[model samples]
Target: MKQLLVPALLALLAGCATTPPTPLAPTGPKIDTTYTAKGQSSRARFLVLHYTVSDNPSSIKILTEQQVSAHYLVTNGPQPVIYRLVDENRAAYHAGVSSWKNYTQLNSSSIGIEIVNPGWTSTPEGGRLFYPFPQEQMDVLLPLLKDIVQRHGIAPENVLGHSDIAPLRKQDPGPLFPWQRLAQEGLVLWPDANRVANVRPIFEATLPDLFWFQRKLATHGFAIQQTGMLDQQTRTVLSAFQMKYRPSDFAGNPDAETAALLEVLTTPANAPLPVVPTPVTTAPVPPLPPATPPVPVVPETAPAPAAPLPVPTPVPPAPMPAPVAVPTPATPPVPAPAVVPATPAAVNTP
Candidate 1:
C-alpha cells in the first residue's frame, strides 16, 4: 500500500511537471512603437487670444466648471501664473461661432489663451475704458505662444484676437491689449508705417466709399458684409479693426488713417493704389427760352385722302376628284319596313 501511494504521488507529480502552465490571457492590446508617419500635422491651426473678464479665482472656477473653456489661462498679478486647463490636442469651448478669413467655427481649429483682466468699464459719458494687460502676464503668454506657434507652424496672420474672429459679437482682448507687442514678437502682421504714411494723403484728399471700406476690411481678414452703406454691422467690424490697429479712435468711422492702414495692410508692396471714384456733379440747365406767343395752327380745307381699298385675293378653283369604282354586290338585299314593331302593337290593340 505504501509503494502504491508513493507511486501514485510520483505519477501525479510527473504529470504536473510535464504539463506546461496554461499561458496567461492578455489583458490589453499590444501596439508596436517602431515607426511614425511623417505625413501628419497638428490639429491646432490658429492661436486665438482672449481676456477673462473676472478675477483669477472666478476665472479658474468658471473655466473649469462651466461649459466654456480654453486651452490656457494666464492669471493677472505682478508674477502671473499660466494654467493649462485643456490639452493642446483637444478642442476647447472657446471662439463660439467665430470666423477668420474663409475659416469659420474657429473653436475646432484654434488654441485659445484667456488672459485674466477686467474687460472694460463704462464711463459716465457713454464711453468704454478697457483694462490694460499686465506686462508680466504678457511675458508669460509670449513664450507659450511661441512654443505653440513653433510646434504647429501657425502663421502670423492666424494669430487672432477673439474679437477679430467674432467681430459682430465679441470684443475681448479689447483695444488696450498690446497688439504692437505681438507684432514685435512676429506673431502677427503689422502694416509698414512708411507705407501707411505714404498712402494716407491719397485717402485724405478723398476718402474711399463704404464699399471700399468693406472690401478692405474683408481683405484684412475681418468677416464683414460688403454693404455699400455705413451700416451698424459694417461699423462694428470697422470698430474691431480700429480697436486692434488704431486704438485711439475706434468709433467705426472711416478716416484717412484707417484707410491708409487698411490699404497698406491689404495691398502688396508692388501693387498700385486703388483709384478713388470722383464725385459727379450735374451741369446747370440753361434758363428755358422766354415763353413765346403760340402760333395759330392752320387746318387743311380738304379732308385726308381716303385709305386705299385692300385688294381682294382671288380664290383658287378646287381640283376635280378622281373617280373611284365601287364593286356591286352579287345579290340584291330586300328592304324591311321601318315601323313594323309599332304597327304590330296597334293591330294587337285593335
Candidate 2:
C-alpha cells in the first residue's frame, strides 16, 4: 500500500514537470514608426447646397434638434448670417436616399450648406410660389462657398444643389435660386447660349424620346429611373434640371428645348460645330437670365427659346483651386466670420 501511494505521487509529479510553460509576449521595435503620406486628398469631396424651407428659428430647430443637420446655415433676415453647425471634417445628416453618378450615401464625403428661406409662399389662387434667394444671402454665401470649395478643392461640377442629387424628393434652392450667379463666378458651369442657338434647330426637327433624356440625365448625375416612359420620375428629373439650367419655366414637361439643353451638356466641349463664312455676330447676352426663365411647355409652340448651351459636368479640383484648412466652428457659426473674397488669392491648406 505504501509503495503504491509513492508511485502514484511520483507519476503526478512527472506529469506536471513535462507540461510546457506559458510563453511571454514579445517586445521590441514599434511598427509603422516612420510613416510618410503617399498622396494628398481632401476630407470633403462634394459640397451639396440646400435651402431650409423653415424660417430662421424653425430652420435652426429642424437642423439641430431634428435628425437632419448641415455643416453651415445661411439666414435670410435683414442681415444675412452664415452659421456653421457641423464640422467640415465630420459627416452631416443632410443628404438622404441620395445618389449622384456612381456615388451614394453622400453624407459620408460631402459638406452640406442649408440656406434659410420661406421656400414656398402661399398664393391666393391655391398654388405655391417658390421664392428666390436674396442678394445679401448670396453675398455671404458666395464667399463662404468659395472658401469651402477652394480649401477642399471641390470641382466646379461637383458643386451641386439638393435637387441635383435628390431630384425626385427635393426642390430646395429652387427654381428661383440664382445658379447663373455661381456660374459667372466660375464656381459652376453654365450652358453656352451660342451652342444652344446652334443646336435648337436640329432638335426641333427630330425630338429624341424620353429614354434618351433618362440616359443623359443619368450620365449627368441625376439619380433618375430609366423607365423609357415620361413618368413622374422623369418629370422630377426635368424639373430639377430646368430649375438649375432653365429656371424660367420648370413645368417638368420635357420639350425640344430641354432635349437640346441636355444634348448641349452631353456634347463634348471639343466637338466641332458648323462654321459659315460671315461676320461672327457677338450674341446678345440676354439680360442676365431672368430670376425665373420663362419655360415654354412645347418648343415648337413659339419662336422657340434656344436651348441653353451645354454646361460641363463637375470637373476635378486641381485646375480650379486646392482647398485650405478651414477654421472649425464649434457650434452654429454666428459671429462675423472672415470672408474668403472671390479673387486670385491662394489659400493656405494643411
Highest lDDT scorer: 1
Task: After superposing candidate 1 on the true structure, give the runs of residues whose Cα lies further than 4 Å from its correct spot.
Answer: 1-29, 269-350
What is candidate 2's lDDT per residue for 97-177, written digit by digit as tens?
A: 888889998999899999998789879998679877878888989999899999999988889998898888888788888
Candidate 1, poorest ten consecutive residues by summed lDDT = 341-350
List model 1 lDDT by residue over 1-350, tens digit each. 99789999999999999999999988889988999999999888899999999999999999999999999999999899999999998999999998888899988899999999999999999988889888888889899999999999999888989989999999989999999998999999888898888778789998899999999899988888887999999989989999999999999998899999999989877787765556798999999999999999999699889999999999999999999999997997878867745443345553
Q: Give candidate 1's error at residue 168 in angstroms.
A: 1.1
TM-score (all chains, Cα) for each model: 0.70, 0.67
Model 1 error, position 11 (Å): 30
**TM-score quality measure for candidate 2:** 0.67
